[model samples]
Target: MVLAHAEHSGPRVLNIGEVLAQLSDDFPTMTASKIRFLEEKGLITPNRTPAGYRQYSENDVERLRFVLSLQRDQYLPLKVIKDYLDAIDRGERPENLPPGVKVSPRIVSDEFAAEMTGRVRALTEEQLRTESGASVPLLQSLLSFGLIQHSNGRFDEHALQVAKACVQLESHGLEPRHLRPFQAAAEREFGLVERAVSPLSSRRDAASQARAAEAAREISELCLTLHRALVQDRIARMDS
Candidate 1:
């Protein structure tokens, strides 16, 4: 969602004032810093005026809403959300629901949850490095972007995509520094997610807490997917 003039045709610029006006109601805590944070995370990129002011399009606003909604309602970590968005950017529509949940318009059904395990893709470090052309620094960059995680020296399918994205960026002369903004954005997103999950974490039963955690993640994934769909649809209309 970087704020480039659409490579094809579309509404390509939106100012901060406009974004705030549009989003202020649905997202009460919405702020310039938060929007900028999303931009830093590569979640939404607003165009710059001749004077270097930020401009966000309708698409950007919707994307931000989806991102914030997920953080507030679903409690997903930024990294997981980014993977879903990245997949959409790559022209793939993720199942969106978590493991063993059915995909619906508004909620995930239990029938669908059972199938989640089959959809997961687990990759080792060597394969990630090999196929995605990700160097240690690149992996570190992905970590900063909140696009992947490192646990005991391994990564998941999300890591593979981040590695691939790095490879894609290399051709444009971009390196890790180009991705530092993502780290900053991630801090904001983490705060949002944490606040949302606090109630569940404080609860008594372990089972309820676990379910709450899963639901939070699933909800965020759904929002990200929905937002991507909306953006693409709007862009397609513009192109047409």
Candidate 2:
């Protein structure tokens, strides 16, 4: 069975050193760079100190545990992992287990959810453009390259964030064409997710559809988290 856990409150936040000491045994390959990568990819948002150092809370550590466990045991790509996380963030807890994967139950107290309640806000494309200051052509370019997408003819909060980032990247001379690799990579990840969810999704029963959706959402978030960690490590090497 795949090991999974949930975040709970803690008395104090932990620094990188403490985080490393705590996680080193379970996730042998976990490095500071990967943690930073998760931060960068918005998977785990750690608070920054006055000195610009990261301070990860207990919540952050549990998130890392879930991420590492999924990558090591499930061999899921980052995209799927991310989708899973996103679903949770959106308050959708999916059936996590699929064929060949058995996830243990995650335990969390009522207090656990107190700090993390609310609806995930979604926005229209026009609203996204208005708020993000993204130009029409830039939005078009992102769509053309498959970087940012419209869901149900509207952009979700995640899509808005991606569009905003793409706008910033454009200022640095990385155009949407340069981001096509990311799109291709996402498609490949989607392919893997489809294979995993198709069997359940194809069943005629009504419950099967819900299960498939849940499975798809969870795996997708898991893959995204994994992707961020792997990419963070590679990017970190450049400074080393």
User: After best superposition, candidate 2 residue 160: deviation in angstroms?
Assistant: 3.0
lDDT per residue for candidate 1 within 136-227, as digits (tens), equals 67776666666678677767666677679878887799886787665565566666666777787567553345445555666567656766
Off by over 4 Å in 2: 1-126, 146-159
Q: Residue 28 lDDT in model 2?
A: 79
In lDDT terms, how accurate is model 1? Answer: 0.62
Could you give the C-alpha RMSD of every candidate to the true structure, in order shown? Answer: 17.8, 13.2
Alpha-carbon runs more than 4 Å astray in model 1: 1-12, 98-240
For TM-score, the strongest prediction is 2
Backbone clashes, candidate 2: 23
Q: Which 10 consecutive residues of model 1 have the lowest summed lDDT?
A: 101-110
Q: Candidate 1's error at 130, in angstroms?
A: 30
Model 2 gets an lDDT of: 0.69
- Ten-residue stretch with the least lDDT total in model 2: 102-111
Candidate achieving the largest lDDT: 2
